[model samples]
Structure formats: C-alpha cells, structure tokens
Target chain A: MAELVTPAERRRLFTLLSPAYLWLLVAVFLPLSAMLFFSFLTDMPQDAPDWGVTLGNYAEFLTNPTYSTLLAKSLKLAVTVTFFCVLIGYPCALVLAKSIKGRSREALFLMVILPFWSNSLVRIFSWAIVLRGNGVLERAINFVLPFDVRLNLMFTTDAVVIGLVHSYLPYVILTLYLALQAVDDDLIDAARSMGASKLTILRRILLPLSLPGLLAGAVLVFVPVVGSFMEPRILGGRMGTYYGTVIEDQFVAVYNWPLGAALSFILLAVVIVILAAASPVLKRAQT
Target chain B: MSRVDVANVTKKFGQAVALDDVSITFEDGGFFALLGPSGSGKTTLLRTIAGFYFPEAGTIRIGEQNVETVPVEKRDIGMMFQNYALFPNMSVADNVGFGLRVRKTPAAEEKRRIAEALELVQLGAMANRKPSQLSGGQRQRVALARAIVTNPRVLLLDEPLSALDKTLRVDMQIELKRIQREIGITTIFVTHDQEEALTLSDRIGILKAGRIVQAGPPREVYDRPIDAFAAGFLGEANWLPEAALSGLSLPGSPGGRRFATRPEMLSISAEAPGEGRNAVKGRLQQRVFAGAMATCLVDVAGQQWKLVARDRDIPELPGGGEVWLSWDPADTLAVPA
Candidate 1:
C-alpha cells in the first residue's frame, strides 16, 4: 500500500483540479469582465481612451418613457404567454400521466417533442407561411365558408405571443408530466375510500402534489419569453415593440452598447426579484 | 345493520380469471377474514366489496342494498390500505377529518369526531404532525383513525398489518380486534397469514385459486378440513398414505383418499406389543426436546410420522429402539387427495 501524503506532497494533487478551475474562469469570468468594462468605457470623438465614467446611459433608459413602457410591455406579454402555457400544459401533462399507456404514450410524447427538433427559424417561418396575409389559413377559411374574413396575422403583438407560447409549451408539458408521474396512485385510492369526490381529490391531492413542476415550468417558460428576440423580429413587423427589440437595436443596429447592457442588467435584476418572491408560493404548492 | 352477501361473484382481467364464482355471507357486525396465498384473490375480493372493482358476474349486497352499481364514494365503506396511505402533506387532524368534511358535517362536530377518533387509536397528542414525521406503526394508527372517523357501515382492511415487524404486528392485531369489537363495524380483513386470520377472525373464509375452499369458525375449519390443501395450509399436519389408516378402519375413511393427523394427537409408548390400540411397529429415528413438548420423528411400518407429547408425558425410549405409535379415532381427519 502507498503511504499517505504530507502537505508538501498534497500540493501536487491541486494540479488535478485545475482543468475545471481554468474552464470556469475563461468561460464565465472573462466574458463578464469584458461586458462590464465595455459598459463603462466611452466611445469618444478621437477614439482615445477617455477612461471617463458617465451616468448618461443609465439616465437615458430610466428617464425615457418609451424604454420603460417597453419593459412593462415585455413583462405583460411574458406573463400572458406563461399563463396560457400553464393552462394548456397542465391538462396535457395530466392526460399523458394518467390515461395513455405503453407505446402509444411514448409515441405521443415523441410527437410533442417533434416540433422542437427542427430549427427555430424554420419553425417560426412555417407559422408565418400559413398565417400571413391571404395565405393558406385565410384561403382555407374563404374556401369553406361564405363569410369574407381575411386574416393578416403574421406581424403583430398577438402573433409574437402565439409564437413564443408555441415554442415553449413542450418544455412545460414535459416537466409537469414528469412531476405528475411521481405522485402515488395509493394516495388517490385512499382519498376515494375516504368518500372524496373525483373533483375534490384532484383539487386537494393531484394539483398540490404536481405544483413543483408547474412552477418550474412557468419559470422556464417565462424567463426566456421576456428576453426573446427572434419571434418579435419575425412576427412583430411593426405593431410589436417588446423590450427585446430595443435591446437588439442597442447591441446590433444602433451600436450604443452601454445602454443595451444597462437595460439587460435591469431586466436580470427584475427577473431575480420576481422569481425569488414566487419561490415560497411554488414551494408550498408541492406536497 | 345487515350482513354482506357475495353471491357467485367472478372477476376477469382479460383472459386471466382473477376470481372464480364464489359465494359467502358475512354476518352483521362480524369480524370475517379472507385468507389465502398471493394471487388467490383475497385482496381482489376485499377491493370488490369496497367497490373498487365491479364483478363481471353476480351481485354484492351490503345490508339490503345491491352495491354492484354503487360507486366507491357512495358505498358507505371505510378501508385501510396495505401501505397505510396517509396523506403525507396534511396534519393528522386534517387527515382524520377528511371523510367528515366530504360528508359536509358541521365544523364543530368534525373537530370533535376527529379528536375522538385520534384518541381511539391513541394518537390524540400527535394531531398536529404530518404523516412523514411519524413511524410506520404511528402512520398505520393514523390510517386506522382516518378510516374509522366517519363511522362507516362496513370496514375493509387490505393486509393492514403486513408492513409491521413481528412484535408490532402482534400488538396491532390486538388493538385492531379491540377497536373492531368496540365499534361493532362489519369488518373484512384480508391477509395471507393463517395464524393472523385465525387469531382475529370470528369466521374465516379460506380461499385458493380464486375459490373458497372452506368457510367456518377457526376451530372447525382447522379440525375438519375438506381437502389436502386446506389441511396443509391451515397449519402443520402430518399426512399419511390412505392404506395406512384404511387398514385400521378410521371413522372417516370409507372412501377417503388420505388421513391427516396433527402432531399433538399421536402418542408413543414404551414397547412394541400392542393390537387393540391400533399400534404400528416403528423405531425412534429422531427426537427434539422443545420447551413445553418433545417432538419425535418415528419410522412406523416403513413410513415416517411426527409425534408430539408433553415433556412429562414423553415415554422413556432409546433412539433406534423399536417402539409402538398410536392415536385416538377422533384425532385422525380424513380428506380426499
């Protein structure tokens, strides 16, 4: 057997832990440092190192009502999309957990995941192809019914919301179904034997037990909804102007990088505070 | 106020028949046991009575109502599961109050009943705690409390004590019997343990292959088994070839296939000279001195049979020495093979 090492020999063991240490520093800390530095540095007339700090970018975002309104609008849209996702996902997950059996359930689960396998841009474009003005959806409606109603649904706030919800619903359903599956069948039977109605059992037992996954799915669906860009870019041709559009303009079109970074920081802080406040309620919902 | 009657009930799961056509009557307020090995349909029968499964054929009547069409929640039955399925999230008070709440009882009455039920199971002090914080036996007590809180007409127990250790199981058995007698609820207990069934039941229904083999009082069923399977399953019995007991003209052996003898009924003597006592010549093959009795295995007429006798009544005999074995006419039970 080998002898145990002293402090001096143990110094050699620290070398084995370096790969993960170096990876975290390079991947996370370095990029974050560049973002912070860029936010502070000024692009001056002579392109010199001004090294001067200013609150101009922060003031511009805070005082300008358009940016603030866009932020509020983004929050509202994210909430609406998240609410619909939960409403639709819960029943879908419940049915998946309770009713389906064997290969049929597997096939159904795979079908729910199929949309996510294609590229996001292509999928969004497919919806645009159908819902665009005088497109297949409008044509089919006109062909079947006598009413002359033309739908130009491609680039609007409603379109963007629909796209976001469609993109994120599979995740919500999958997470909720996994949680619902963990509930004990014996609990349901016990409740039934206690003279509880089916509705009462669902309200008192099934819904409460599956709440953790519901909250987790809501968070997963909501956080990205507030920060989404592609859906708004593709579908919100003019009518939709979420906070992501402004963030994208600052970083991509306007080249005013500091303002965009400040807006991003504000969004991050708001999301953290809101989710933390919701954690207690979500935790209580489960079990 | 009336007994439960199950008449020619059969349940089929696809091609596998879970229960054959079986009929049995449970006396009003009677403590009956459905005893069998696994997959023998004891649990299924209990569940059917609880209205969990509808029989494919036949009628089940509780009191005077035909419960075949009644749903589980409307069946007016209380049930305890094998796993003691207490609601893990709710406090003991809430769990016990659930049935009363469902029946729309007044809050004051519900609270009083919950307290009384908890005290019945000796869990009055732990009403504020969750089931996850309790021990297996304590959780079981809570389950029992929850089931009895509503004063249901019939109580169903599905192997309720199978999860406990030996000491706890015995203690719970006594407690459960006391509770049943005090409440006087028509109770149907399901278990695979023959001793447990015998110890707790007023009448036992022994089942095999989804059919009832014998249904009677514990003593009668054990003393007068109808077949070989019944005699062997109820307890330990020594089986002898039909010819061995036929030669001696045992009372029940006119057309009987075999004779079954309990170990305690066989007796040993000092020597091998006997004829009027229906003695067989044999040598002592082995002897075991149990605390209260000594069990001896003797080879009689080239066949081995076990005999038990009180330590004081044990005859002085040497191992490998020839001896005479005899038993009374009433002790031998004859059964078809």
Candidate 2:
C-alpha cells in the first residue's frame, strides 16, 4: 500500500521536471525570495544582531514625493522612447520585408543588426562622445547651419530618448520584421489586382497582418526602456534625476538596502501592470 | 467590344530576357490561352498586358488606347492569379465587391453587382465566409467573382486551376470555359498543361523561351505541328531517326528522308499488309497489354517503333516474334532534327 501510494505515478513526473525545477529554485525563485525577505528587515550600521521585520522602508519611499516623481519620470521616458522606437521601426521593418530587392535586402538587414552586436558599454560611450560639448556631430551641424550654435545635444530628456531608441531599435526591427515577413504576399497582390490602390492595400491588408509584430516590438521596447539605468544616467548626466538614481542611492550610497529593495519591487509591479495591459492587445492581434 | 493588341512586347530582368519581342492579338470576347512550360515568359507577358510590368519596348492597346505607361490599377483589367490570391481577411462578398468598391460605385449598386457575381460563380451561400474557410476550388471562384465584378474589358488568368487536384482541375476547366463563354470577355489563360489548354481555349499560343513558337487553333497546332518542338509538346509521338526514311518523300528534305509517327496512328500485324506505302518489317521487341488496348514495340531498321491498337481479331505476335509495322502515308509527319 505504501509503495503504491503515489510514487509510482509521481516519480516519472518528478524526473521529467527535476532539472528545470532545480534551476528555478536555485537561480530565480531563491533570489526573489531573498529580496522579498530583505525588503522587510532593518539592519544596524556596521554591526550584527539587528534583523527585524518592519514597514518603515516601504513607507519612506511610497510617502516621499521625490521618489514618486522619479517613478513617474521613468514611465514617461519609457513611453516616449517606445513610441519613437515603434514609429521608426515599423517602416524599417516594412522596407526589409517588402521593398528592398534580393541580396541587397539581406545586406541592408545585416547593417541594421550590426550596431547591436557591439557591446552595450561601447555603444553608450560612443553616444557620450557624439553628444558631449563640441563633438563631431555638433561640429558638423554647426558648420552646415547658419549660426555658430553649440546645440545642447546631450544630457537632456531628448538625449535620453535618443539613447533609448538607439539601444532598442534593433529589437523593434527584428520583431516587426518577423511579423511582416510572415504575411502572405499573395494577399497584397490580390488586393491590387482586385482594384485596391497601393494606399488601400497598405491600410487594409499590410498593416493588419503586421499588428502582432507591432505589439511585440512595442512591449519589448517599453518594458526594458522603463527599467533602464545606464543610458539615462550616462546621457542625462546631472539632469538624469530619474528613479534609477534614487534606487541606486538607497541601495549603494544611503546604506538603506531595504528601501532600495522595496523600490525595486515597486518597479517590478509597474512592469507587471504594463505586461498585463499589453497582453490583451497581443492576444487580440493573434486572432 | 474591346479587342487587345500587344505589339513588340519585351521585358528583361538584369541580363535575363524574361519576354522577347512577342506580339499577339485577341479579338473581343475571345478565349485565348498562353500555353508553355515553366520560365517560358507567359506570366510575364500576361503581367505586362495587365500593366503590372512595363516592358522595355512595346505598346499594349485595350480597345483603342495605348496603355503601356498606365499603372496596373488604372488599366482596368481583371487578373486571377494561380493561387486564387483571395484576401484572407475579407469575406467572399467583400472580396467580390472590392473592384466595384474601388471604382466607387454606390453601396446599393455594389451590393447588387456583388450578389450577381457570386451567383454567377454559384457561391452565393459562401458570401459571408472568409477565404481561408473555403476550399481550393471555392477560393478560385471567389477570385473569379472579384475579377468580373467591375465588368472589366480583359480577364487574365495565370494558371488558375494548377493548384487544384487533377479531378477538380478537369471540373474547373469545364466551369472556366462555361464562365468565359457566358461573360464574353477577352480572357487570356496561362497554363503549362497542354490538355487543359486544348480543353479551355478557343485559340492556343505555344510559347518557348520567351517567344511564341506556334499560335493557332488547338486542333491545327496538334494535328499539324510546325516543327519538332510542337510535335513533341502537343502529344506523344514516336520520333524516328532521319536515316530510317529511305524511300518516303518528306517535306523540306531534298531526297526521301525521315518522318515521325504517332503511336496511335501506326498499325501492327504478323503478316504484312498488301498495300503498304510506309511499311517496315521487324521483330516484336516488347508487348504491353493495357486492358482495352495493347501497345507493341517493333524493331525496324535499327530503330524501335511503338504501335497502339484496339483488341480486335488481330494475331498476337509473341515478344521476339517477327512482325510488320505500318502507318497510313497521311498520318506521317515530317519533323526537323
């Protein structure tokens, strides 16, 4: 009776899942659990034996207007960056999918993806070079324009958006490209032959078929841009008074690990809400 | 009454010439077919006429207007692609109504035309269903409906029935002929299947390597081929070597030379016929009984000849037995090497 209790059936299931379960426990679940636990604890400065459960850290971040403002700024930046990425990405994807001819199309596609292959730090530093005071781009623009204007190209909200768009444009292009390429070209030709003009074909057939790619690309751009710390910190410079700095200050400089952990959890919750909002659009597009 | 005249149409993609300087004329309401193998430029020719592809040098006249520079949508010609090309997102009624809608016909008139087109294709019940939900043949009918909805002057079909199964293809061939007759529009069908071309076309144009090699009625092209290519392409023919015709006077051959014989035209017997003008004595090489008829292979003058005959009161020559192969002089066709 003991032997036949459940092991005979459950053993196979356990074997089937043991590796993935172990990985989740060791890599993902354990770290999240530690963060959750640490968020509620208070520790003494440079001393032992001060661990206690408390809501003070959560209260300080939630109640503080500065932290709340930083959070809102991050979201606004993410939305703006995602919008630009999608607008630019869709036409690039369409060109890759439909317009460019044969081998040149493949070469152009490779050029679009080439920037992403470089290390992110190098890419960020290159932006730093171009956006700094009197960089090459600034010099070139000044030479072309009428007046000698040191255009404030870097360390602004616009600079942050530019960096974000540069960083995530590849993702948008790749996802939208996949979606656009999957469209049955015959459908487009059919519309044209049936007397639908080129504009009508795009409006009726091409756009709808590529909706899933647009949704996926939007989510991919938005989610990461929301949580990004480097580009805004590097490009925004002093004006980069965003949520990442606040969270970093709490975690690294202020010695308030719990508060920083709490802030991270709040950011995670925002991401969840975003994903929830985006999922329905994706599902609707699929059918 | 709209007649189509294509003069000196040529298209080239890079260095590869897709369509040579080919000219063809279609009378108003003529059911013509462009028959050829793959890469023979039939589709390119059709697309050029439809104005999708502008030729390197040519003029395409529909009625009396030269439409070489006109865009595809502005040309007002209907085209049915091989895969039917029905919009997956649109319902059958919407698909059929697309042309009328494009022309900006009123909603009531569009609805009436849509209904009539669908009725013509016998797809009235399937009006509300999307193209993906329909069968292969049904989708083709919807494409037909869509093409004919606006009453275009010329209808172009690019191997429209090639995607269907063999039986459905035959059924659709009959249906296509019937529809073309009823519509009385200048219809140009492109297909590689010779039988389908013969069945559906009022006139057939055989293309080879971007040029029309022969153009005539299907019967004339089949019964009286111009050269070796047409003879081999139209149907089965036993091509005899030139050296085999020692005593027959063949066309274009200065001396008595070679000719080709269709298997169905040649008669076989154990004893030689008394009044045989084109007769050769040989031994039976192989015999294959195909239910109603038997196909016999006879080796004559260092060449093998096939004879197909009905099962009648004829002596059956055993394989390897002596036999005589003969055909009527009228059945022999002179072919160039």
Which candidate ranks first by lDDT, i.e. highest? 1
Model 2 chain B poorest ten-residue lDDT run: B249-258
Tens-digit per-residue lDDT, B205-300, candidate 2: 988899988889988888778777788787767776555567653455634433687888877888877664576678888888788888888887
Please tell me the TM-score of chain A for candidate 1: 0.87
Q: Write the per-residue lDDT of candidate 2 for residues A185-258, one digit (tens) a residue.
A: 76777677667888888787888878888888888888877778888888898888788777787777897778
Question: How far in Å is the alpha carbon of A92 misplaced in model 1?
Answer: 1.3
lDDT of each: 0.86, 0.84
A157-267 per-residue lDDT for model 1 (tens digits) = 878888888899998999999988988777888899888998998898888788889889999999999988888889888866789888988888998777787777778
lDDT of candidate 1 over B1-337, digit per residue (tens): 4589999999988898888998999999999999988999988899898898999999999999999878888998889999998877689899999899999999999999999999999999999998988998999999999999998889999999999999999999999999998889999999999999999999999999899999999999999998888898887677765446545747553563777688788788866535545555678999899899899998866778788889788878899998877777677778887
What TM-score does candidate 1 get on C-alpha atoms? 0.88
Model 2: residues with Cα > 4 Å off, grouped in runs: A1-25, A43-48, A55-61, B247-258, B274-277, B280-317, B320-322
Candidate 2 residue-pair clash tally: 0
Chain B TM-score for the candidates in order: 0.91, 0.91
Pairs with backbone N, CA or C atoms under 3 Å apart (clashes), candidate 2? none
Model 1 chain B: weakest 10-residue lDDT segment is B272-281
